[model samples]
Target: MISIELIRKNPNIVRASLLKRGENLTILEDIIKKDEEYRSVLKKLENLRHERNVASKAVAELKAKGEKFSKEVKKVNKINDEIKKLEGVTKSIKEEINEKLLWIPNIVHEDVPEEEDKVIKEWGEIPKFKFEPKGHYEILSKLGADFERASKVSGARFSYISDKLVILEMALARFAIDFMVKKGFKVFMTPHMVRSKAMYGTGHFPRGIEEAYKIEKEDLVLIGTSEVSLASYHSGEILQNLPLRYSGFTPCYRTEAGAHGRDTKGMFRTHQFHKIEQFIFCREEESWKEHELLRENVEEFYKVLGLPYRVVIVNSKDMGNAASKQYDLEVWFPSQNVYREVVSCSNTLDYQARRLNIKYMEKGKKKYVHTLNSTLVAIERTITAIAENYQTEDGHIKVPPTLVPYTGFGEI
Candidate 1:
């Protein structure tokens, strides 16, 4: 959530953010109007309370004198009634304001493009093939990807990996966890389900709710990424650590509600996948540096795997709701002759901390901590990358040299 104080002081800044995101400007206007009304009602309530206090005092004094105080008592009672009504009104208005604020996206960084993705950096060499390359689904199925059984059990966008494919997926996750741990991150296997509060805290609710898998008659929902769990871990706490870093591995669930036909053939887009996420909580002034560090960590992981990839700055309209700035690591897929998104790094810049009520005492004052998240690896997609890139002429897959120690096999 954005700071209401920022809107109160300069609404145009918030208005510009809305414009950049192509959001309804009227939401901002409504929040401003509701905020003004809340303040007005609050002032009136204070006055009524003051009047009731004075009237009660007068009634008390009259009673002490053995005099009738019915009129004064009634006056105080009426003032009390007025205060009660105004208090309810104030509360309702505040709730409305908050509801609107929750819908607002974070302010975009000035350097971010308005719409089109801006390619900032490229790494590794795009692989050249001696023959026409096969798609990951074609290569991986031979290694035991049982899509037909998966569809019979769970429908489309699902896969059952057996044989070497299962080992490859596990190796991908293990490789990511070990890499992140050595980079000074505390690793966790986070819970697969989280409460609505956790979802909202991570800026994944009230808008992206359609993409989540919620438990029936319960507040819990299957998490889409470990970032949701990691971000909410420090909720409602005051931290002394300035740059707390964490890496979490979890099975993520998603509905993929908006994606109907895209990447429907294989593991590239799926209903469930395993991921290792990188998260950091730091002072506001340190988030940009932390953001770069997060990006470098994921980039290095890909480099070690010898995968060709490009980093793109996500545009304002295309970035996640919580991110002030975002970068996507798109790995090469020789079969499609395109780079696909496998990792994302973002700097939320206190957007999530404010919503989660997470704070840190700095210079004797409490302030929201900026939060950042990055995907170290998405097991299914990374598997797809490796299968296609390292395919042998004999229709086998070679494990990336970096993950060979984990898989204990050079080829599949």
Candidate 2:
């Protein structure tokens, strides 16, 4: 949520940022008006209660003097009724303001470009294949993978890994967890199901609610990524630590609602898949540096895995709702002859901290911490890229040198 103080202080700045995101800032006017009305009603309630107290005293004094006090007593009762009505108005307006604020997205960073995302850096060579490249699914199916069986049991867009492919997924996950833990991140295998507040804190709710799977009876939703659980773990708390990093692993679930025709042929757009997410909470001033550090960390992981990738800075309108700035690592997909996003790193600044109320004390001053998250690895997509990029002409798979130790073989 944007701080109301910010709106009051720089309405023009807010308005321009929203316009860049293609949103109208008039909603802030609605909030400001309701806020004024609420404050006015509160003032009326205060004066009315004070008047009622004075009338009560007058009535008691009249009774003590053995004088008629019925009119004073009725006036006090009427004042009490008026206060109750004003209180209701105040409550309703307050709720309206809160709901409106929840819908407001974070302001974009001034440095973020308004145009399409620009490539910041290109790493490794884009492979040139001597033979015609088979798409990930085509080659994998012939190599004993079983998406057909998964569809038979769970319908389209679901996949069941069989034979060596299952081992590749485990190797990639284990390799990532090990690599991240060595860099000071606390490892957490988060709960797959989370409450709605968790979604809201991660800026995935109220608007993104449709993308998640809801368990209505339990009042829980299946998380799209462990980022939601990791971000919400410290909600409403003031932490003693200055910087807390988490490497979270989970089998994510999404309805993929309204995404009917995209990536339907493979595991890339699936109802369920595994992921390793990087989440950080750091002092506000150091957040931009931390954001870069997160990107560097992912780059190292991909480098060690011997994958060709590029870093693209997401533009203002493309950064989504929460990130003030975002960077994506798109790995080369040989079959598509283009790069596909395999990891995304975002600096949400204090947007999530404001929403979640996560803070740290600095020199006796309590302040909201900036939150950042990145995709360390998405299992199926990484496997797809690896399979497509590293296939030999003889129809064999060569595991990355770094993952060789974990997979117990150089080839799969």
Candidate 3:
């Protein structure tokens, strides 16, 4: 959530940033108007309380003097009633303002592009194949992808992989963890389910509620990414460190409510998948620097796997609610003859910190920390990429040499 103080102090700046995202500007107007009313009500409530205190004191003095104290007591009681009413009004207005604020997305950073089609960097060569390349689903069907059984057991958008395919998935996850650990990140296997507050703190709730799986009668929601748990780890705490880096590995679950029929063929779009996410908490001024480091880390991950990929700046209108700027790394798929997103790196800045109440003390002053998250690897998605790119002409799959050590085999 944007700070009320920022909205009050720099409405124009806020408006300009949101305008770039094509947001409805009316909410800004509504918030400003309601905030004024809320402040006015609070002032009235304060004055009423002061008046009640004075009247109550007068009543005490009158009783001590053995004089009539009924009038003073009545005045105090009447002021109390007014204060109670004004307090309700203030609470209502504050709730309204906060609701609007929560829905308002983070302002896009100036560096984010207006279009996502522009590739910032392209790496490796698009592989050449003599025979026609089949999609990952067809190729993996012979190898261990059993969507038919997965659907029978858990409905559509789920997959059951055994044999070498499952081994490949685990190897990918382990490789990603080791890669992130070398990048100054502490690895954690976070909880797969988290409270609603954790989702909201990461700016995933309200807007993204429909896309998440929730417990029927509990406050828990299945995490879409380990980013949610990682970001909320230090919620409401004041950190003494300048920068904290952590990587989380978890099996994520999502409803895929918005992606109904899209990418339904394979594990590309699934309800459950393992992911390793890189998260960082740092001082506000150091966030941009950390953002670049995150980008480098992601690029290196794909490079080591010998995957051809390109990085693009996600358009402001296309980015998630929390990210100020996002970079998506798209891996080249030989079968599709195009690139597909395999990694997304974003710098949310202090938007999440404010919501989670995560703060850091600097020279005795407390300030909200800036947060950033990037996907080291979405196991299944990367496996799909590898399956397509490293497929032999005869349909067998060749494992990336870098992952051979983890998988204990060169081919799957």
Candidate 4:
């Protein structure tokens, strides 16, 4: 969500954001009209309350003079009724404005590109396999994974994820937590199911229902990422701490609503998965630094795994409604013969903070905190990269040097 105050003060700024996101500018004018009517109602309500006060005083004066005050008392009662009616009208108008505000997205940063995503940098070399490298699904099945049976039992895009593959996935998550926790990020095992309010606060509600799985009876939805939980942790609170950092490990669920028949062959687009997310809260000026720090952490994690990858700056048109700026970490998938998105880092600035009502006080004044989040480890994709890149011609997987200690074996 964006601050209405910003839009009220500068409509062009908000207009430009809407235009950059490929939205209709006319909606802005409609919002302005609605806002004006809301303000008009409030002003009338205030004046009515003042008139009621004055009428009450007149009735009291008439009674004090020992004259009949029935007419004066009747006028006071009528004014009170008018005030009560206006109060309800005012409440309705306010609710209307709030619902419209939720539909408007956050403003994009000025420096972000408005066209296609830009590749900021690339890392390592795309490995050259002497023989054609098999995809992870084909190779892993030979290594003891039961993907065929998993599909038979649960449907497509499902995997048994058994044997050494299970250990490797767990090892990837544990290694990420160990590395990030030491870097001053608080670790949490967040809830997989969150209420609609939490989803709304994280800028995932209303728009996210298409991609989210809801428990109809429980009024809860399964989270797509741990960032949802981490972002809502400080909702409606004033934090004395600046730059609060948190890492959450949690299972994720998604319907992939509009994405039908895409990435359907691999774990790249699963209905369920595990992830370790990095979420941050900081002052406005320091948010960019924190954003880069998160990107650097993801880059380093890929480097440690010896997987080739690249970082791309997501353009304004592509950056989602909640992010002012964002970066995608695309890792090499050997069998796919191309890089795939494994992680995304975003600096939402104060967009999410405003929605969650998270604030911090400085110099006796309160301000919304800036928020940023990134994925440290999304187990399935990371495993796809590792399994494909480290596989030998002999049909075995060579454990990456960094994860070897954690996995307790050189080969599987």
Q: Judged by TM-score, which candidate is best?
A: 1
lDDT of candidate 2 over 21-132, digit per residue (tens): 7787688788878887888889998999899989999999999999999999899989989988998898998889888888888889887888788899989987787898
Clashes of 1: 0
lDDT of 4 by residue, 71-124 (tens): 878887888888888888878876777777777777888778888888999999
lDDT of each: 0.91, 0.88, 0.91, 0.86
List candidate 2 segments past 4 Å from native: 49-76
True-structure RMSD for candidate 1: 1.2
Q: How do these models rank on lDDT, best leading?
A: 1, 3, 2, 4
Checking candidate 3 for backbone clashes, the offending pairs are: none
Assess every candidate by TM-score. Answer: 0.97, 0.93, 0.96, 0.96
Give the Cα-based TM-score of candidate 3 against the true structure: 0.96
Any runs in candidate 1 off by more than 4 Å, and if so which?
63-67
Worst 10 residues of 3 by lDDT: 110-119
Evaluated with lDDT, which candidate comes out highest? 1
Q: lDDT tens digits, residues 1-412, model 1?
A: 9989999999999999889887879888988889999998999998898898899999989999999999998898889888889989998999889988899889988878997999999999888878889998888788899887899999999999998788888888888878987999999988999999999988998989999999999999999999999999989999886799999999999999989889888899999998999999999889999999999998999999999999999988889999899999999999989988999899999999999999999889999999999999998989899998999888898889988898899999
RMSD, model 2, all Cα superposed? 2.2
Off by over 4 Å in 3: 60-66
Judged by TM-score relative to the true structure, which candidate is superior, 1 or 2? 1
- lDDT tens digits by residue: candidate 3, 1-412: 8889988999988898788887878999899999999988888888888888889889999999999998888888888888888888999999999989998899888887775546899999999988998899998888988989988898888888999888888888888888887888999998899999999999998899999999999999999999999999999999876799999999999888988789987889899998999999999999999999999999998999999999999998889899999999999998878999989899998999999999998878999999999998999988889999999988889999999999999998
Of candidates 3 and 2, the better by TM-score: 3
Q: What is the lDDT of candidate 4?
A: 0.86
